[model samples]
Target: MSQDQSSVSRRNFLTGTGAALAGTAAGLVGHSLFFRPSSAGAVKQGFEWPWPYTELDPEKVRKKGHAGYYDGDCAEGALYALVSELQENVGAPYTYLPVQIMGFGGGGVAGWCTLCGALNGACAAISLTSKDFYKLSSELVAWYCETPFPSHTSNELAKNGEFLVNKSNKVFKQTVSNSPLCHVSVCKWCKENECGSGCPDRSERCARMVGDVVAKTAEILNAYHFGEFRAQCSESDLAHSCQACHSKESPYEMGGWSRGKMDCTSCHIKGHASLVDPHHPGK
Candidate 1:
């Protein structure tokens, strides 16, 4: 009867209704262990950032720093920024969380270049949102295998590979060459020289290659995440393997390890060396 009592009752009713709706939606959608339903409706419906809305305190945001730019601390500033933008614009929640997790875990920097970061991010998001991680991952891999990225095409040249290259020539080619460092400028040069190590134009091409790789990587990721190719590669055994290997130590660091320590080179040798296994001390 009283104004305060009426307001409290109305709030309680809304809260209860929202919870019921979320539960029903989760069940209908098939739950994923990676994604937990939130009490917040809009946030739970994949329209905003995956973080809990109620937990988004200003102090916390500030402490976390820029929503979506690359931060050296986690190499996920850009991802966070993208998620924040999605939250502001489309209100999709948890859509990018899986990507953020994988990226931060060192998956983003791996040389596979087979899947763009955006595609990987989207896949991660799906994994998080699906009810069964294994099943969903498998489905995603199957989808991606059939619908290859533009770079994956064979006759196109400039755009026919898992990773795109940019040079004055605008030509694209895919090969099993090693990826250069993450520097944008260096990547440009490598792309121009076709990943050659001794060409005179190598330096210039390398610089541009760096920029091209970063830009292309960002572009592909965005497309895969938002475009119709959402089903590409439901379960990536390669990604899964990378995740497992990197969980111990990055290949970069392992490269310089002494014989006493684990040597990635021992297993993944290139050219002739790869044909012969370096004898393990015990074996």
Candidate 2:
């Protein structure tokens, strides 16, 4: 081939390759910018586990939780109340969170009547926002096991039409379940209120329960964010005695076979202690 012809061919090849490279680079830059998140926007940049959190008002969360119950029942309502607030406060990841994923947790995990749906939702939110999830979650559950459902504040809110949804204005008789199990909580409330579990009054009671639990969750999360969180709840006195012989920390040979901090009396009879020696922990 002639030198000029060969030189022109080489020049053309270089020009084509350079153009292709430039186009590729521009595409990459555009892609990065488009997909990169910003906390400044409705979705934030940080996508790490235990997402960022800021202080939230418990009263505001309480109202939202009640409304959310009407929207998606107990679990979804509790989670939506907390995460939706976070979406407004921190944007991004929290906003992107699909709270409906927790809908199955309603009525104690799809009505199987296991863990309380509100507690399940609160735990999910707590796990998302705090590394100390277990500790905080235990505190929340303990508080629930002792605190009466549909608190006076919640009843007043309903009476005054302050809740996002005013399903009932009647005051409910509050009862402590001493257990976090949904069946126990609901049955106790039902027995006290003298209503069927499927009754509107029961539903309203659960709605108020969602409000109370989510509000407490908000308060706990806010305290943690501000470094003011403290564990105000602990294992039940009955549980402490039972755990002395049956928990991971127990020194007995047969002890440490059991795990968890749930109230022992909830599932087991106090007669179990009599089976052991008089010197047993509770004895």
Candidate 3:
């Protein structure tokens, strides 16, 4: 063949190959975007706990005063206690023999809002550690102590009278017995404004609701021994509080420790920057 012809032919072949490769790449990219695995509910599903119990030591937990239906290092102590009780009551393979307790710095604004610490802890524990949804559900119900709340209650548990009574007189009595005086004042005001004359005892009502929720949460934790509940509760509450507090301002908006406009990572990283340092400059 002529030299010019040979050169032309070689150029054509190279161009064709390059175009084919480019087409293949484009097709792959298109397929990935259009037919990628659907993760629409990933976050919702991810928030669920995966197991019946965590793996932590019961003896050590008790020694540390971490046993009971509401005793932990901080905000979710009730969750820790519940789990400890679960270990004692449930026993055996389900108890997470050598429990692995997770840590929480403290309960944030949510605790102040009167949310039950044990419920928060239980939510955290399930979301972060459990793999089996049924087991997680069972554990949650057990922690709470009353029958599983309606939506997920099974025929068996419910038939056995495990159904939670939304307005139990017994719970009301307990609440009245345990309510703080401050709560009583708030209840009185709420009653006078919301229910003119025949307001059911407000303080007792509030106490009952709070106690029922807390007691139920503790009951669920009683079926597991690991401290996953504490860890998750602490992290979840902090995450929620941080998000709420930082949403309104920008890092530079308000001065002084209030990096009002800063994103969570930016501020939290700074706060925990010295976590590992023995002689951190800030410390």
User: Which candidate number has the best TM-score?
Assistant: 2
Candidate topping lDDT: 2
lDDT per residue (tens digit) for residues 39-157 in model 2: 33445344666688888899999999989989999999999999999999899888788999999999999999999999998889998888678778888998998898889999999
Candidate 3 residue-wise lDDT, 41-70, digit = tens: 232221112334434443233222222222
lDDT of 1 by residue, 1-283 (tens): 2322445433344355445555444532322323445663444443322233221222222222222222321224323433443355445354434335545422235533333333344344333333233443344334433331222222232233222222223343322222211232234435644665344344222222222222333333344344432434333354344334343334644332222211233234355343543642222
Each prediction's total of clashing residue pairs, residues at least 3 apart in sequence or on different chains, is 55, 3, 37
Ranking by TM-score: 2, 1, 3
TM-score of 2: 0.79
- Candidate 1 Cα outliers beyond 4 Å, as residue runs: 1-102, 105-120, 142-169, 175-193, 196-283
Is candidate 1 or 3 superior in lDDT? 3
* lDDT, each prediction: 0.34, 0.83, 0.35
